[model samples]
Target: MATLRLYHAPISTCSQKVRLGLAEKELEFESVTLDLLAGDQHAPAYRKLNPDGVVPTLVDGDTVLTESTLINEFLDEAYPEPKLSPDGARERHAMRLWTHLVDAQLHPACRVVTSAIAMRPAQQRLDREQVLSDFAKVPDPALREMRISVFEHGVESPYFERALRSYVDVLETLESALSSNQSDYLVGSRLSLADLALVPYVLRLDHLGYSHLWQNERRPHLTAWYERLHLRSAYDAAIRAWEVAPAVEGMHAAGSAVHSRVDEILGRA
Candidate 1:
């Protein structure tokens, strides 16, 4: 077997996605944990492997893969038995579409909430200049600006409101999709890349104490889909362990304190 190594942070949603994919394939690999909160991801050595300096980088022999969705697809193709892609071209297209929605909509919104609620407060406790410097290290110019705004202003940042609204919209989309699909997984009756792509975001919703947004009597499909994900052993082995990280715990605690504010923003209050 070719050697496989993953560099990741425990609480990172992207990292969790990759981990779940690995676990589902019953793949054994070496783990290299990066302390994202401590600025480990921004180090020059790591940046060589991932120019964006993000977590959940998969290194298989000479090949280095970033981007959680792509990495998950790679894992699936590499180990086909518990296949993570659907059999037909149409189903595969749907799977890719779902993953695209996550990247295009859900992921950025999740980052805004995570930064505004959890990471911003944590950053405030650190050196201000260093925090700004860290924000500068983000490779994407637009994302860098958003991070800087949330870092400086926390909930008062304009992006927070946008993030809140975006999340609501995405949840509505997910609820409708799940209700209409009549499948436990996102794209088909079986678990596929689309399901793995989204599971981490669902876990993030729960961790952020925002589960009630879609866990109500009216959103049975969304609730049921989430529950089905948890029933998988890979969910616990690959994803759940990270939920208890000290940084993640701190974020969750911070998220709990802002429950009323978020509800008000979403008009759930």
Candidate 2:
């Protein structure tokens, strides 16, 4: 019952994740929109709130929470009516690991693709192929090898191509995780943070005009699961209500953790 405010950007998937989390809990909070495209987060006033200059700087009472995964976890635990995360320690850890992978690896690669593809003006395009070639630098040999076999699946190269690979990998893995012949949700056959984290990505896939790629013959189970989530009233309002221009292109839609968990998850020095 504390005063709550959210700093969000239309194009930010991370912010959207928090929005979905809050909505699922049925918590009513005020929303404040920030202009990420215009560099508003860099202003002196906002900098004091979040030095990182990110879209989702959540203000809960007097506490300011940055990071999408943390913020969403706080809402889940704080509200706790319709849980967004699971109960057991093992389930929680699994969810945390998946969230970290999506937030760290997939989201950044998606940004690289988006900035190169559509985030830039047509004439201003920075040559995505060159950008992708440059991506080979700070490289993880494992990701690079995965990136190659991924490209063989039939997608063009460049930054966005890597995004496509990551996207497909996520969807396929998720589909296989669902119950063999009967299940709707992602983890343990119930709605969890895993599903919520993924919904925004799926939403962006449609926004980017790649809806067909997720259709029947392509990823039937994944498509079905996404559609099922779309029917939830909370999902419809909290997550889908906002209008997004896509902070970047081809693949773009992208978290934080709770105060209590920070010391546990990140571990205090």
Best by lDDT: 1
Clashes of 2: 12
TM-score for candidate 1: 0.96
* Best model per TM-score: 1
**Residue-by-residue lDDT tens digits, candidate 2, 124-230:** 24555643453343236654454433333222344445565676677677667653635577665478887778788777656655566568567878788888888
* RMSD of every prediction: 1.3, 11.3
Q: Judge candidate 1 against the unseen true structure and give its global Cα lDDT, from 0 to 1.
A: 0.86
- Quote model 2's TM-score: 0.74
- Ten residues in sequence with the least summed lDDT for candidate 1: 240-249
Model 2, 39: alpha-carbon shift in Å? Answer: 1.1
User: In candidate 1, what are the lDDT values of residues 1-269, reduced to their tens digit?
Assistant: 89999999887889988999999998978999998767899999999999998888999999999999999988888878799899999999999998998899889999998899988878889999988888889899999999999988877899999987887787788889998996787887899888888878877877777778777676788889889989899888897765667666786799898889888887778
lDDT of 2 at 250: 29
